[model samples]
Target: MSAWIEMISDEDADADLRAALDLARTPHGTVDNVMRVHSLRPNTMRGHVVLYRAALHDAANTLPTWLQETISSYVSLLNDCGYSLANHWKNARHLIGDDARADAIWAALEARAPERVFAGAELALMRYAEKLTLEPGRMVAADVQALKAAGLDDGAILEANQIVGYFNYVNRCLNGLGVSTAGDIVGYYAENEAE
Candidate 1:
């Protein structure tokens, strides 16, 4: 366990974390440790969670929940946000049901994303996320057009941007504060019972 992590009791958080804990349906019980820590900044964390749910509900955003989680894992890896990575890595494992592939996807993406099965639109979206993260100002109309050409509707594009932007926000908060991971939330992704 890293020194920066702090667990929030149900009593400590506002309705936001409480709501998220219920929505996430964490396998064991309670919120993820990252959320627990973010419970310290309840308003900000709640806003992100609300946006994340909205992003998923938008019909144009075709990526499945697990795929979105995978994308988030990739971004967390790029940003070197350990707390984010730990949370999303567990999400990818549980949601995608292939931890090895989850690991491989990131490796493949880093090596050369387009070279893998995720070429074309997916690659474009990932590249767009990188640019938005590393150089937001550099993004031009052409990038959005490329995404449109790749078959993303405006709504999907908007949702993708929102999700990516939110993760960037998360990365900054965790990385800036030097947040670290503890084992408390790892059980959130423990194997579901109905398998």
Candidate 2:
């Protein structure tokens, strides 16, 4: 853990932070460093928890959870945030339920060539995520039009956009905070959304 970060211990948490912390805890009763960093402002922690479930784990998502994790992992890779990459990659693999296929997809992503595992709208979404993460200022309407041209409806496009945006946000937060990767939490989005 970075010396700069003053993460609140569970014993020291106040009612407000404790409430947000409880909501963000994993099924295994652990809270990720990514969320723990928001201890100083518990509302942001609560917002982060809500957005996390809504954007990536909700049953209403038009984009599949596996794809959301893949997008998250890919964006994490682009941002050089190993914490998010490792965490979300595990979810992606579990949701995929085929390590071989998941490995191939991850390998392709690591090589910065998602084209090997995706085509059409899926491929377009990966490319868009790469561009959005690497060069957000350059994004324009044409980028979104390309997704539509590739076959994603507005709802799906919105989901993909939110996934990319969310990863970018969390990735920056994790990386910027200098969070330690030791004993990092996994299976964050593994539980069924119906739960």
Candidate 3:
């Protein structure tokens, strides 16, 4: 599907936007449709990249990278965002170490039955992600309590909630804008296979 907004092309970018676009390139050596969509407002895109890096890549984060990827992928799947789902799932596979397990975790998340594949604090976090995504209004202190009961300290719980919130916002942006996943899926899987 074509994006609702005109994706900014390198040829069309101004000097400032070109610099932002340069910073937005994926490891696969191309700008993502998400970034291209946001490129219409380069300053917003710059702030977005900063927030994204901090939420998912800050060195001070205590949550495991794989768990962060899992939360992201789970949130994407819950929102049925094909773009984010494919990309995050690919990253989760790289971190989780087995294709079947990665697929199973995704399936379990989709089924809302993570017990089939996850346990302990991981399961708690996934459950929290689900509740927060599907029913943010209904979420109460009890939800946070569950994460704590599962052994997540306050900081870890905060990080998990932020990741969940971030993905929910991003998923809506991509899905609402009809961001295409066409090239991304193929490129991501090919790169994964090479790795």
The models' CA-based lDDT, in order, is 0.68, 0.86, 0.85
Model 2 residue 164 distance off true place after TM-score fit, in angstroms: 0.7
Worst ten-residue run, lDDT, model 3? 183-192
State every prediction's TM-score relative to the real structure. 0.75, 0.91, 0.90
Model 3 misplaced stretches (Cα beyond 4 Å):
185-195
List where candidate 2 sits over 4 angstroms from the true fold: 1-3, 188-195
Residue-level lDDT tens digits of model 2 in 2-40: 424898877899998899899988777888777888998
Model 1: per-residue lDDT, tens digit, 32-114?
Answer: 55455565566656665567567644555667767677667767777888777777767766887776776677677566463
Best by lDDT: 2
Rank candidates by lDDT, best first: 2, 3, 1
The 10-residue segment with the lowest total lDDT in model 1: 186-195
Q: In candidate 2, which residue pairs get closer than 3 Å at backbone N, Cα or C atoms, i.e. clash?
A: none
lDDT tens digits, residues 155-181, model 3? 999899889989999999999989987
Residue pairs in collision within model 3: none
Backbone clashes for every candidate come to 0, 0, 0
